[model samples]
Target: MEKARRAMFFLLLLIADFSVAQDTAGEADEFHVGVILDLGSLVGKVARTSVLLAAQDFYTVHRNYSTKLVLHVVDSAGSDVQAASAAIELLESYKVQAIIGPQKSSEAVFISNIGNVTQVPIISFTATSPSLTYNSMPYFVRATLDDSTQVKSIAALVQACGWREVVAVYEDTDYGRGILPYLTDALQEIDVRVPYRSAIPSSATNETIMQELGVLIAMQTRVFIVHMSSIMASLIFTKAKEVGMMNKGFAWITTNGVANIIDSLNPSVIEAMEGVLGVRCHVPRSQELDNLSIRWNRMYQQDNPYESPFNKLSIVGLWGYDTIWAIAHAAEKVGISSARDKQPWPTKSSTCLESMVISTNGPELLSVIVQNKFRGLSGEFDLTDRQQLKVSVFQIINVVERGWREIGFWTVNGLLRKLKRDYSKKTGQASMLDLNPVIWPGESTEIPMGWEIPRVGKKLRVGVCSSEFTEFIKTYKDPITNATTASGLSIDIFEEAVKRLHRPLSYEYLEFDTADAPISGSYNDFVYQVYLQKYEIAVADITIRSNRSLYVDFTAPYTESGVGMIVPVKENVNTDMWLFLKPLSTEMWFGSIVCFLYTGVVVWLLEHLIGNEHVHVPFSLKQLAITIFSIFEES
Candidate 1:
């Protein structure tokens, strides 16, 4: 009887062993996620790929869960109709317990509406539309920055760059549509504004959208703040080039939506992206982000899941790893994985979000992370008093050669060059060059209420670069000293102008004997000739180009002199009227007539269009057009 019982037990054991193995293999073959996607059609593909990889790699290593995550991808594909279809599939067909995403808010609303009815919690990775959280839509949670935090962070971003104008181009979906008011309000505090804005629809093709980008090109807005996701942005850029609207001077900026696939950065795209400025909660990918990358890279490299030709791939890959770490913070502490043997996992569910930090007695497990600051590759994901993510510190990045460089270098010669009292040093070698003393937060200096040239001798030789000076010299010599004062005037007049500084003034004269000489060309030749150790102070009404300013010391010019386009008196018969008019005299009278008419027309147009401020700068299309036309005429 004992032998018979043993035989029966062995037979039952054998049957169970095969069944368990078959189930394991089946689980390994598939993983699932509940995803909702709409207007972010193209980005949905990439994001879904990333999430799928995360699920797959995590399962491959540890087999603790009863079932492996088989990402049940549901695509709204940027359509309301399709969004509803995808949502029904995930809820009914997949029976997924926890959902990962509905990428855009337009489609996300449908998921939110069904949340309480279905009792499934939705964890959104990138749905930033404003309407998502309104009216206490239960069962909704976010994994990415919302439009408010995004715009506020952007406000900090613009403040960081000291930029005043940002051009925002957005699609008319909840994702883009919901952001403008908050963006405007946030920027208003920082004194920054969306000067030129365009609203595009998510359905617009590349060609349709690129036409709008042409206007950005014409506006020449320096900072381009794009509220678009990667898909539409990639389209706008491609079309911008196709329509001949791309230029090197533009500064392109975008939200974190474009931060994911940074590896798309390559010579072809990056070269044109020199001034491309974008924002990402993702820690700007660097060699620092790579330590985590090596692990995941070994996991999925076999599949070539990434199609990004840009090195930005390496960055996003590392940041994605950071995402895993962030999840580990929650899951390993509060979800199915938190080991109770350790300390508390903070609030077991979302209710404890207020305490920002999650602590556990499983120090070894938590210690595997926790030590290196709260920074996840996406950025420092610190919590606020209100259970919100605070990443006020933003990293502004520029696309470089197959890589990315932080937008402003360790140097400020680029961003601060425009301030009058403050300036940039050309060599970037770090020497103070501001006419205004550099100030620290606690210190103050008396700005030389202004600078003055102390009175000095008019006998000094000044360096000069105008042929007009030479022309005057040829016709008449100072019968006293045979020195030719050019433009039929005394260099002493220039000297006298400097003496008004209420300080000792010195006068010097320099002559440029030719035309066609660049200020750089002339200075190099002149400096090469003079030894400045002696009475070598030189002065001229030399137009300062940054390069030339470096080699010599120049006093501020009392008058700016440039070669005026000389046209022979013709056509409207002004020559007869000008026979008695000498240069300055004629310029005086004709200038008045021209100036009055110009001012009158400008004021008239301002009143005609933008309604009332007659003396205001041109802000309307018609006024701007007239101003531009007049500038062309004047030029």
Candidate 2:
């Protein structure tokens, strides 16, 4: 009797468990998914909470529809191997419709493989490693940025701070290693010179760091860029402080860098880390986050309830959260139905969901991707190309006193214009270039690095105007005799400059003849005589005006004297009248026009001629200019 009673209870228990399992399995025809993640790390945990909360909100608001969402969670403990195992199990065994959250690069790489095999869509929250989509995983997508998007920004910040020589210390893994090539390409494209880089192993020691630091110090490295863990950053900062370098002032630029380690920091640590500048691609201040912070603080008493204690770790983490929300919102746009009571929810496999992807790769899909603009929680997001983020936004932030202050925002065109080539093409002013080409801010590579040693040669004879107020260097007789050698400040500068360019230099005293020689004719003779490889180049303190740029290329000018008056500085002189009135000065301006038209014809005629100096100097046709200038004025 007792055995029969026990059997009856066991049978009822089995029946109840079977009914519950049946409901969950049969409900799957409505979209279901698996979220694979670490759930332990601060970034992972925050991402997990946001997605779950969002999905809950998405489903509850759409209950009028028959659609249902069931999400299964899988913990990988931040291991790629485990993440892959879990992802495969979801695709093959449980057969989820799609997946989200392979929060780091290593796992994302392997999980991408499962998406390929099963043809289920997968999107990642924070895997920025390059070559992401090429894992034979056409079905995969990333909800985060590519590795190189803000590398130029990071390099710019470093260059802006005038940290010319840097030492790179990166983690050995894919996340850390991925930064290597892309950041290097960015640095190189900007022509920045990096002296040393160290690829550190995961098991790096204080001794290894010390050895590398010693090598860097030997090379005179003053800045350190730590591109690894917070653990690594804290350790290096502590070591730097111990080495007395931090206190004595060494620049610390962290890549994905940090200002202070909040949870791990003490009063002394904050003081030690004060001067460190971390390079981050800052997000524009979002009204959504501002509002969220207000509500979250009132309820949870935290800056970011969904974020870690390092709440403002970077705008990157917030952007990641926004990426997931953006995908959901875009899904709503395309999957939405007009009938409120009979709408269909977006399945993870829905064709409507596929149409709105802004990052779908392939030559054909580029136009479609560009057409969609997503409104994310943080801000709007779009893609201009496969690897490029089209958002024209960023800021340089200086973190201080438990908050951040804006250093400035980087507008796309504004920054480019700042770095646009220094030539006068864009500035519309030749006068500016003639005066100053490279602005040496009391500091610059005044002499380029590794300046080439000059070749020894016979002294190069160069000529300049000898008029007292001009660039002409005078010659002096030896005490009693009437022979001469070169002597003047301009002469010295030209001589030294030629040697700087590895050319020989000699000087010829050009005493201007009493007669006014036709300038177009005389210049032809000067080029044939002075510039015929006899002297490699000339620096005559001559006003290039305009005609010279056509006949000969001028090295950046050495000196420019504004039109001067022999009258005393104290005297009242109508120099304005003298400027256009002096026949010699007017010729200097007008002959420039004559030479332009005449030189081209002369150059073309002389090109293939075989005679010694076959090109005849063209006489200045004053009739041509007298006609045009008068016509231009009248018109």
Question: Against the true structure, candidate 1 has what lDDT?
Answer: 0.52
Model 2 lDDT tens row, 477-560: 456753345556667786676677532334444332213666554554444444355544543444565655555666675666
lDDT of model 2, residue 604: 42
**Residue 443 lDDT in candidate 2:** 22
Best by TM-score: 2
What lDDT would each prediction earn against the true structure?
0.52, 0.53
Off by over 4 Å in 1: 1-33, 37-42, 57-62, 65-70, 156-164, 205-207, 217-222, 241-249, 265-267, 282-388, 407-635
Give all TM-scores, in the order shown: 0.50, 0.52
**lDDT per residue (tens digit) for residues 1-635 in model 1:** 99999999999999999999887665532223465644234455445446656655665666664434545666676676687667656654554444556666766677766553444455565677765663465556555557666665566545654556777788767788788888899888867767767988877976668667655655535456677766677776666656544443344567766754555533465444444555655345466456545544444444344543222233334333344434434343333333222222244576522222222322332233223336555666432221126544444455544456553321233222223334444321122131112221112221121122322223445554443354222223466885644442335555566667544544445454444566457656655444553335544344556665666656665554665887786568555765775656767999877976787577566556865553265467876666656555654
Model 2 stretches with alpha carbons more than 4 Å out: 1-30, 60-68, 205-211, 257-272, 294-317, 326-372, 383-388, 401-404, 414-635
Error of 1 at 397 (Å): 1.3
